[model samples]
Target: MAEEQEGSDAGSEEVLLTPAQLIRSLEQAWMNEKFAPELLESKSEVVECVVEQLEHMEENLKRAKGGDLKVSIHRMEVERIRYVLSSYLRCRLRKIEKFFPHVLEKEKTRAEGDPSILSPEEFAFAKEYMANTETHFRNVALKHMPPNLQKVDLLKAVTKPNLDSFVFLRVKERQENILVEPETDEQREYVIDLDEDSQHLIRYKTIAPLVASGAVQLI
Candidate 1:
């Protein structure tokens, strides 16, 4: 019985990810989803896998002794990695919310035609997680009023193409207007508002390439 109890405890032990390992895992997940979102499987799995690691890091931070320079530096490094992980996940969540809205189903088994982007194990974990926390995707992500997005969020959004979506940008270089209509004002500049930093409102596709080349920045 003692041996069996020890085995059970061992099986339940959590795996801790090193700060570097967690950053790499999160970044890889983000890049894969960024390039081929449709092909990327188990979106939440990618994020959820690091939850324990994040928690462990947080626990260490909470108890960390102060005044030691080494400890202070290490804590900042951990915090930076934590921020990266969070920003990566937030971007992915925004993509999921915009593109794959079906996975958040709290009611009814996952609907047809919406592929289980998560593996069977991951799906099971998510179902259990949501039930335990009473959380939906919106609650985790889209809830509450508008607030300042992290710097990375703005950077990622501008670089990615979201057709039919409106975005704010500052034009550093000029490109031919593809949306020009016949008899329209020739060389008419497009300005959404009076703000000098953000004067253009254009479809994402029109400016995506330019933004990728540092010709524009999302405001």
Candidate 2:
């Protein structure tokens, strides 16, 4: 009976996550700001604040700026974090349902179900976690970007006949996302917006007005 009880306990356990581990993961994901040596040291503390805000249901991200220290918080990252968290929540709910399927059935009968019971604060926490993940991915991309972009015709730059062969040209001066436009059958133009993700120079294009403007540069 004791062995059976121990086995059951192991089967029903939830994995435990340490505060330190959580903080490290979160810090790695939301790191988009420049800092002095002293400031960089304080990231652990700032991450703690984020963790608390999430635990208590608060939205605490600062609006990113474009300049000396460029940081682009992609919306897609936020969505990815939310997606992973939502899946985790569903898995937990499924486990709960297995033990108490009646509760889910009853929830379905109600106007709003158990899933609806999650607080806004909880959702915010999930976003925080995702933001951390995004920041980490961006940092990894930056280290590998090419120093120079060559033979990259303004026309071919945006149209990018070969997506796989295309290189990402980051605009350190502007701190923005690249805007691509197709001017005519012969040419394409691309503009880098300083407010988008700084780590990757996205390959894309727009049509027409680009040719008329004419001015282009590699930065």
Candidate 3:
């Protein structure tokens, strides 16, 4: 019987609160409503200030409506300019294509024909080409030339035998000698007197048969 009475008492003591009572209870428990009025007023003022700035910006946008600036068709303008440029290029391209065959033929003729037949500009170009080609050909030929031979040796090695009907000898002064100079022509019989005696000088260009046959061999 006592336990039942205690349970009833506990149940009856459990307080029920309305919405206003609950809010009052929370304010008292946490002291939330006791904050300084100055802070709350400053927060409200900042919010109002932001709202006023936004309203001013909105009014400025309304006044400026499509008047404060202008926009250009930049990409379209570029494309149009490119198209105009391409029109001139198209003319040049057609001109080049139209004359391509003649140009090719002229080049071929210039390349193959005698250099003397070309115009001044064409001839100059051809000459340059010829000079370059000749240099290249010479370089290739030089690579093929015998590498170990000196210039003189190469000359001697590469020279062909000379064939001539006439034989001639040159007689020129040797230093201070006043002696008669001996020489030979293509003809057989020619003679010259030696100013110096046999002991004082050397005999040169004495023909073998002429001397043996008692022919004049001083020359």
Candidate 4:
């Protein structure tokens, strides 16, 4: 069929940064950003790679402009690439937002506890970028949005009375000398164990520091 030949012809032409490659690139970017928290003074190399390939893809798209089917197919593929990029950045943004306090205090803090991980340079960049991003989210993304849609930025969302609930947590790090609520005046108890999970009737504020320090996680 003529359509089949057209498809074959288009497929024969080399395309830049296929969807799989783009997805992989984004994943690598996320990993680098996460694991190399101390070296984060540099922008993500993965993001740079993706943007370069994206530009190449855009050029190809321009060349394929006359072919409706080719353009359509390429558009769909491009959308996929954009989605991966957006999802990667948003995920990073969410983590950064959640740990904004840690970022402020320590350049490289663990997901659970107070020991620092980021170098001075990485911390400065992260803190500045996060502050700007949060401002943008507040001023643009969440500003004047519908009431129901307003809670999309969960990090900045105001707590509702019904929103509080009992949670299960798994301990992942040790916190020394933490004061426990009950058992009267013993004052300091090594309250948690590594890899031990427990359920508690508590508020977010009660465990927020633990969660921030990578000492505990909701399970």
Name the best candidate (by TM-score).
4
Name the regions of candidate 3 deviating beyond 4 angstroms. 1-71, 105-219
Of candidates 3 and 1, the better by lDDT: 1
Every model's TM-score: 0.37, 0.21, 0.16, 0.38
lDDT of 2 by residue, 1-219 (tens): 001111123365443345445443443323211110001111233334444534433232344444423223444444455554444344433333232222223333645311232224433443454455446545765346674632223222222122222223333244334456554679766664543224443332221112112212112
lDDT of 1 by residue, 40-59 (tens): 34445445656656677678
Best by lDDT: 4
Each candidate's root-mean-square deviation in Å? Answer: 15.7, 24.5, 52.9, 15.8
TM-score of 2: 0.21
| CA lDDT for candidate 4 | 0.52
In candidate 4, which residue pairs get closer than 3 Å at backbone N, Cα or C atoms, i.e. clash?
Answer: 108-117, 108-118, 111-214, 112-213, 112-214, 112-215, 113-213, 113-214
The lowest-lDDT stretch of 10 consecutive residues in candidate 3 is 33-42
Candidate 1, superposed: residue stretches over 4 Å from native = 1-22, 35-39, 101-115, 118-219
For each candidate, the alpha-carbon lDDT, in order, equals: 0.50, 0.33, 0.31, 0.52
